[model samples]
Target chain A: MDWIAADWGTTHLRLWEIDADGGVSKRLDSDQGMGVLDPSDYEPTLLGLLRNRLPEGRATRILACGMVGARQGWIEAPYSAVPIAPLAATRAVKAPTRDPRLDVHVLPGLSQAEPADVMRGEEMRIAGVFASEPGFDGVICLPGLHTIWVQVSAGEVVSFRTCMTGELLGMLSERSVLRLSVGSTGWDANAFAEGLDRGLSRPEALSSSLFTLRAESLLRDLGPEASRARLTGLLIGTELASVRPYWLGQDVRVVGEPDMAEAYSRALESQGVAPKILDSEEMTLAGFRAAHEALAAHAH
Target chain B: MDWIAADWGTTHLRLWEIDADGGVSKRLDSDQGMGVLDPSDYEPTLLGLLRNRLPEGRATRILACGMVGARQGWIEAPYSAVPIAPLAATRAVKAPTRDPRLDVHVLPGLSQAEPADVMRGEEMRIAGVFASEPGFDGVICLPGLHTIWVQVSAGEVVSFRTCMTGELLGMLSERSVLRLSVGSTGWDANAFAEGLDRGLSRPEALSSSLFTLRAESLLRDLGPEASRARLTGLLIGTELASVRPYWLGQDVRVVGEPDMAEAYSRALESQGVAPKILDSEEMTLAGFRAAHEALAAHAH
Candidate 1:
């Protein structure tokens, strides 16, 4: 292996060793995410994870993305303002390391000022999507903890907005009053469809409808599966109501894990739109490769 | 003291000892709310709090309202459907207690089937407001962890809706991503007003606007106090937008704790709706008194 690609997020760190032939030779995963380590500990944590994977030669170059580039991360790769390419080689920042046999660069995130939003690791993943399908226009929906809806044109991220639907759902299900009514696993298609219609037509009643899940459970014995599914549908439905401009009568692509992509696909389909779902991991690796190649081309 | 008035809810237990002349002789509070107790523990918990306050008599009558009547409570008091008077003495359930000295009556909560909503302690508090002003024909806004808007006519609750604004704000401020940007105490009138306008005008953009708070804090150095105030404005603003039908062209009365009522007052005032702020504790006590008097009248 001549180099490495890393996705260092808040909760998890994943690394892929890239051979000279542009192929991943090995992969490593760890719990040593940016959130857990102090500033000074970043270098040691990375070195520990890269110990046996290092090539027996000069310092090995590691291209990294995500929270590792945050202000609180190893080294602050200041956010690259939007209306620009997702991954810019000039924007990547160098991480300070005491070890002589290691070299690392953390990619910058993307930020928008008007609507006021910032994205870290997702930028690279979006860049990967662009790498695979160059000149792609229209909307790309990336679902996760903070689901992002990006408007792309001419292979550039024009504008984007993020919804805290996933995070809010997790909080409501685990910490809020609704936790008792909703369970962890279940799928009720009927209830989900009902919630979707309610949320889309009456976004204003979102707050009141949330409590209805619990009330119905107590009064009418609404099943746990239905409550859980309805909660998901309601949130996604409200999100769709807001981002109508992005998905309505537009060519849409959802890039995410199978489950999340399927969820977004289902929501979009409900709104009379069919979105092409793409594998997120492949797009992510392609994004890393794009950035790595951009740096290599710059070096050449 | 002649008798006791208690407001027991999910997480709190409050009691007021009433003299023969209808004056509060003493006040007591405990964390032993319905949530922390099993059915068998309710009597012992109540006895522990009423240890020294019990008046010497054949049996002390305790008029209680709230979740002490919930299914998981001491004994299910059963909910009285809405489009009815706030407190129905006929629906009050007698709790089975081992202590002969304690005669406890737990008032039923109010429930609505259509929109699927319920209110426990707030019902008694509203009843108290109705007791003082017997013909309140407009909207009664009770702000708390879960704010309730009750449409009243002829001293009866016609319909109601509950918004999880306060609880959502709490979760976001203390547990969500915005926690880092918002503070516990701060008042930015300008920020709050801006947030209100933003929320009311484009409630669909609420989720995106929340992330903007954090982004602005990081990118533009938005202060903690301003962020907190903006967050409050956004939630209350969204709530006002949804409950516009309740307060659009009607006289409004806000019944809640001082701080929460004040917050609601400021939000309402921004919308050009000046609401009359009433003391929640007083209303709650008055409601209990009304129920007690009604029970007495029934006996006669």
Candidate 2:
């Protein structure tokens, strides 16, 4: 194996062994995310995941990203200041390891000083987008627990904003009083569209609008499917309103999980913009491979 | 005791005995709110709380308001349409009972058709405000898990809005990633004031601003108290911005728990409006008493 590309997030640890031909030879997945480990446990955790993969004497290079580089991670890779290209080799930090046959480099996340925003793993994903599509320039959105909107130009992340839409929806539907009314399995495209418009028009009423979902469920018998869609729609709608400056009349691409990226595409299409959906897993691997190539070129 | 005045909500049940002169003779409190009980458990729960207090032979009148009147409560007391007086005694419904010793009346909550809003216990508290201050005409804000803002005139609830500020703060602070950074106790008045202003000025950026709290905590080691206060201030600030029309150039009264009502008072004062704080417990009793008296007068 030429190298290993890993994405260690809050809840999942994903790994891929890259061959000399730049192809993924073997893939592995685990529930051991950085969130569930103590700093001392990271080395053992990685070794357990790569039990038979590492070479006997020679060191195996591992390029990792995500929350594993957080301050509380195995080793903190301080954030790279914004308005810079996504993957700069010098910004990567070497993580100390007891196993002599293991060599790991954790990439630094990006940070914006003015709005005080930060992103760890998504930086690599955005880098992958730029690596493949050098001519692509506009807005890039990665929707998840913290949906991120970025302005990219000339192979650089100009500015970005993070919205707590996904987290808010999750908490509201699972923990809030609305939990009793909203169900897990259902979708109402019509309700979602209406809620989106309402949220965009009256963004200030976002909090009140959330409560209305529960009230409607009780008073009007709004089903779980419609309620779920409406709740998601309202949050995403309000988020789009905030980042309108980034996406309006501009080329927009969504790089996220299939379901979330598709949802963003639909929301964007409703607003007269057809957002292209990029495969997030492919982008992540591309970024990791690009970083490995840059490191090899530098050594030569 | 002449009758009982009770406020049975989702999380709490508060009761007060009304003497002949309309004075509160005794007060009782319990955690047995309508939420934890089924239809079959309501009568037993009430009996358990009023064991020796119930009169031996004749039925003792219990005038109750709040979620107890909700569809999922002891018995459904249908909502009274809005744009009507605070106390519509004719709309009250008597609970079917096996014990003749209990004469229970659950008052209907208020409902707005246009925006599809509803309030149960708050209607009684607003009614109490009208009963005491006949000239009170501007706005009444009751802050809680679900804060409510009402425009009242001529003893009628003209129009109202509900904000989930309290619930949002609770979930974000206790459930989101910020929970790890924020302390359970700490305060930064300046940070709170600044956050409130930021939230009010840019309500559309509410979600982004929330993420900034976590960033600030990580980047600057923002203390827990400050994080808690900032989280709360932001939500309340956005809510105030949404309901600016209700409090602008109008008399405002805040009827809620001391801490929350005081917080609202501070926010209002910052906006150059001095809001009067009324004891929510007292107001609830007064409204319940008023409803009971109206029922008695009709019988006479």
Best by DockQ: 2
Candidate 1 lands at a TM-score of 0.98
- Tens digit of per-residue lDDT, candidate 1, span B39-157: 99988888898886675656888998888998888888888898999988988888997767888898898999988888888998888888888887899999998999999998789
Residue A24 lDDT in model 2?
Answer: 92
Query: Residue A86 in model 2: shift from native, Å?
Result: 1.2
Residue B74 lDDT (model 1): 88
Question: Worst lDDT window (10 residues) for model 2 chain A?
Answer: A84-93
Q: What is the TM-score of each candidate against the true structure?
A: 0.98, 0.96
Judged by lDDT against the true structure, how good is candidate 2?
A: 0.87
Tens-place lDDT per residue, model 2, B33-101, is 988988888788889888887878899899888899888899999988779987888788998888988
- Candidate 1: misplaced stretches above 4 Å? none
Q: What is the TM-score of chain A alone in each candidate?
A: 0.97, 0.97
Give lDDT tens digits, candidate 2, residues A1-300.
888998998888999999999999999999999889998888899899889778888888999999999988879999988899888667788999989889999988999887888898998889889887986789999998899999999888999999998899899999998898788887889988988988889988898898888778877888888988888889889888888997899899899998778878889999999899999989888888888888778779
